[model samples]
Target: MTIQQSYKITPIANLLGRSGSSHLLLGLLTVAPTGTLAISDLTGSIALDLQHAKPHVGKDAAWFCPGMIVLIDGVYEEDHNATTSGLGQTGGIGGTIGGKFIGFSIGGPPCERRNVTVGVSDGVKSENGDVTAGAGFGWVDFLGVGSERATGSKLRRTEQRLLGPDGAHTGTAKMVVCGEVNLDSPSTLEALHKMLRSYATDDADRMPMTVVLMGNFVTHAVMAGGNSGSGGSIEYKEYFNALASVLTEYPALLRRTTLVLVPGDKDPWASAFSAGASAVVPKKGVPDIFTSRVKRAFAEANREAGVKKSGVEGEAVFATNPARISLFGPAHEIVLFRDDISSRLRRTAIRFATLSHDLEQGEPVEADATMMSGGLGTDSSTRENTMDVDTPTPAPAAFPSAESADFETLMARKLVRTVLDQSHLSPFPLSTRPVHWDYASALQLYPLPTTLVLADAEAPAFAVTYEGCHVMNPGRLVREGRGNQIGWLEYDVVSKRGVVKEDML
Candidate 1:
């Protein structure tokens, strides 16, 4: 009996991580083979794509070097032609005028070959023709973190692994992500009822290993009412009282599922929050605690109906808005932020193009397509559809003026890429968008994450893989009175790939 079972409890304050009955290994991520070789976060003209027939004696360096964060002292090849599209004016691109090498995109004034070589601050001079005239300014491999993990999240079919307990297979365990469960919308409320009812009847696969629900549960109406009830919307307290009945009716679902909720900025209970404006973790109590009234009411109603106490208190969670999910043994991590930071990013990010598509950092980025800089007047749907070059676009709004309160741009798919590339969630200057000065380190998204859920209402639902991380946005349950909508995210532990989709609730 020396092999007595032992389960490692994660430090997460709320989740099956601590409460599940079965002892389980936690935070386990499959690691790539380790070796010493040069690696860079760069792609364009300078990165030598070293591929060999049987792989060279030293080329066994497979994708993202894991668990290591290194520093590279090489020069940054400044994109000379990089020009921001100023509002109302069409600016010329500053990239190299070229004959087809990727040092830089073809642009700028044509000139005879001038300065053939350049010297670095280190007094290191380049050889003749080593630099692609204006195309590549500097290409050097400096020392960097040489962790032996792959660079991006796309898992080759051969690399898949299971994420649940030790005995679980790769295809068996799944995580459910949904957002904007506005309690005000009857349609949204009904959608939950239907979902629970269906699962109550489903004895086979009703329970997913975990479910995350992001919120604006109180909506603007409740907040404006000062919690007293406004615009004929029911008060916050009444809303939870009613939700109790729904949860009680589907007792089976209450028993099986672990529900985790994170609050959104617009959520009624969150209005008075003054901690960190851009921070995702809720400053108040956990989101599920709001539903405690429902549990209490359920118990009372059951006794009144001449029924036995269901003994179901609903194993629910109240977690920070941007809580962290850890799998220690696998070394896998997931960070969930429920607010719509995508909207803020579009407002202040320094940009090159209107991101036609989500950038897959692991693979080559397709760049031949022209990006139309839709100004402040842009809407989410317009940004989503702008990639279809053939689509006729209306004039983009005037360039945004930060000082002017009326100005705010809404860039679509590009927002996520900008955030990932910067390795920070709220990339705008702190003055532009302040984060909690004390907890700022909490938002540093370095080494990236195995999965990042950006549940936003301003952006469409999308799943994009960037720098060995999965970035997903599950929009909202209801938009503009149209209810019965849901966003879904599915991640396969073995492959490190996630599938994201949105549909009728």
Candidate 2:
């Protein structure tokens, strides 16, 4: 059912009275005591049959994990077999509803935008001030920038004054993000230097406000027992020292822009313990223990430039792997995550086989090898023959030209949808994508951010926009064999648009 439909979520306890009638319900999808799937809410639980259930959005199958909260549209049959137990058996919610719910369609709850949730807009506050300010989480500062209700309006006005087209400094609100920088690789450092110098040439007023450098700073697992890994944690510290040297050269850039360092799975601490294996989500940032030299470089640069507002003073921030950057409070939020999520998702993805649309339409259904490799291959032969049968429900203006989307483009679209629709960075089970239970809240994308910087070196570098949220990947900073060329992303915070850029030496 569409959002516009007027519907009430029938409580599980109330299901028995409305037997054989269709109704909508909101509950958690879980396994019952009998090992069968069930849905449960506070009132009680009922057995669920989703074998033939389709996603509410027919074009794409909504991801359904056991712990996910979902909306189900189905009919309740009181006479259906009770071999599958209901959730009431496992919890103290209530007695079993004694019915089977045959689902028609299922989907994630509709996402809320920042403006609506924060009451940041003049119109929103004027119309629903009492409700939004009191009920919404607008008073909580998720990123520690400032509470949305408290500073959202003031920051927004400042944002327009500084970033709006009619304002004075329009182009200065830009961010430069580089994907993977292996400090051990001289070429990568040289390429980064070139990128820095290129930006440093811009007038002071036109400089980017932030420069994000994501990691895997070393060429290989620093903790692995080998010649390369011999240095271990100490060697890892030296790599940052080398990077510090690079930053010292461009003191002007360091003094002007905020340097955000986001660690990768292969970065220290976690790497030292996990041996570069799949680390937990919301992993700690590169420990201050190693980033001291990098911090020193920033301090030296600041001292060279003299005192200024602490907010404008250039400083290096070692942010958590999955970090949120709030600019203009709730007006804009940028999420930075460095992981090969595209690869992990495909490895654990549920592959379903159904008749292709082409076959149903009596058209040729050609199977290409590229479709099997997670749509990363860009060979013309593969692109021409492969059909994007699995493309997510196309957005009205998101793709613009759906038929012409290549495998890489299709992959980007799939990645964006799966992450945003679920409203969680890691939607897979704990086994597939381990998340720190306590910090799991950090991974939630509720009221989705304005932009997501998914610096996945494994995923093809491409920018995709879905449902007003823009996701970009810089891919591998310097692909092997592609000498002296570096790929990165330039995002215009004012316009909320990103352009993939490459610098060639």
Candidate 3:
């Protein structure tokens, strides 16, 4: 969102007397007990009139939910003609401030790129026209990949040496991401076997650096029969045993690539307890007890290769539902989350009336593709591998060819904007999308990462770039109507590109 000029924020309390005067206010939007839209701040709460309000960004660019804190520009009107006390007149403490705030424009705060927030960006411009340098947490190592100031330069040099024009084009910088790997499904297992075998055929140097397998892992909830004595636990363990057999057949792939296992809502423990219901995030990974056989397979492979069983050559990682993977120090940060966020957003979103014709005079925001391609005015290479720079290479064939106004494109934009602007994974109310309070910080997207793998089976398989952050959803492993073909995404770290690929069974 672009700022035309500086505006001072007016407290809700100050609006008590200043009727008919325009003021900018920052507050959390909420639904009052009366079922009317209201904005609340520590100062007070005020009813809002947004019947004709236009979002500073485009109308359909974002999903407006009640829990979001936003900037609202409008005028205040007093309720002098009312018969009874409007809000704070004769009511108790924490009563509503007088009258309705007439909103003209509203939008969430602009998101900061990871580079700019870490003081590593090459002089990116802020809304105030000042160079944002040495701002934010430049000293912290959120991902344990050395502090930005200490190891940033060294890792950048290494990145250039490996991915630049003069560098080697080894496929080590690429990552393979596959989602919804239901272990009990024979078709899913066949697809997984084919994909791994195909990757195993790659020459040693060209092997993918990391292969991420997101899970439902079973057709139904694990431990659904209840208790350890029930058949649910036994069935769940057998699935892993079957997976171990698959891994044992491809020891070379196991020895060469890091396999990251991220659990989905239907995975064990949580799934067992939730009884096929939506579980709170960020959920714990599949329990170690159920994955012992898979670990043994990796150990056996490492031993056969004559390498330290625990060395970095290759191994399986059981990661939390929402996890971060950092490579090349602070250069690349990829967040992996498995959930049905799109459906949830649609279900809980606040439906705004269609944008009025008079409001059409407002400036239209650029499309996501345009905004992603240098809209932020930062050169790509200097901004920690953002796709801002124009490359001669063609976009992957599977990249969506639909126009900006396409329904899928619009939904993708709305989802991306809502998530990125809020800087939170699940932006709905806690009741709608429960978050683990203690680990809530793990779900923040602040200093937005370079890539986001949101394994949402309900949403279409899409790769969308917005505000320099690339979000991709591989969807389910098998497309129902597409001849049972398997689909997944291949993300290239150096090029900052992701392509969806499908293979026939």
lDDT of each: 0.42, 0.71, 0.74
Which candidate, 1 or 3, would have the higher TM-score against the true structure? Answer: 3
In candidate 1, stretches whose alpha carbon ends up further than 4 angstroms from where it belongs are: 1-172, 197-201, 204-206, 221-234, 273-282, 287-289, 294-314, 328-330, 350-413, 479-485, 492-495, 501-505
By lDDT: ranked, best first = 3, 2, 1
Best by TM-score: 3
lDDT (tens digit, per residue) of candidate 1 on 1-505: 0111222322111111122122111111112123222222221111111121111111111111112111211111223343533210122122211111111111111111111111112111234323223422223111121122232122222233434344256433456677777776677777667555544565534355566777766555344435424332236556666666667776555554556767766554545443224533334443444567755644444455433443333355656656777643214568888777655544432222212243466553333211222221233353333321212212122112222312112232344434554455554444455566666665666546667888878777666543235667767655445555554665555444566654575
My TM-score estimates for the predictions, one after another, are 0.50, 0.78, 0.84
Clashes counted in candidate 1 amount to 37
Model 2 C-alpha lDDT per residue in residues 177-248, reported as the tens digit of each score: 998899988888898888898888647877788999998777677776645453777778888999999999
CA RMSD for every model?
21.1, 7.3, 6.2
Error of 2 at 182 (Å): 2.2
Model 2 whole-model lDDT (C-alpha atoms): 0.71
Q: What is the lDDT of residue 242 in candidate 2?
A: 92
User: Which residue pairs show backbone clashes in model 2?
Assistant: none
Top lDDT hit:
3
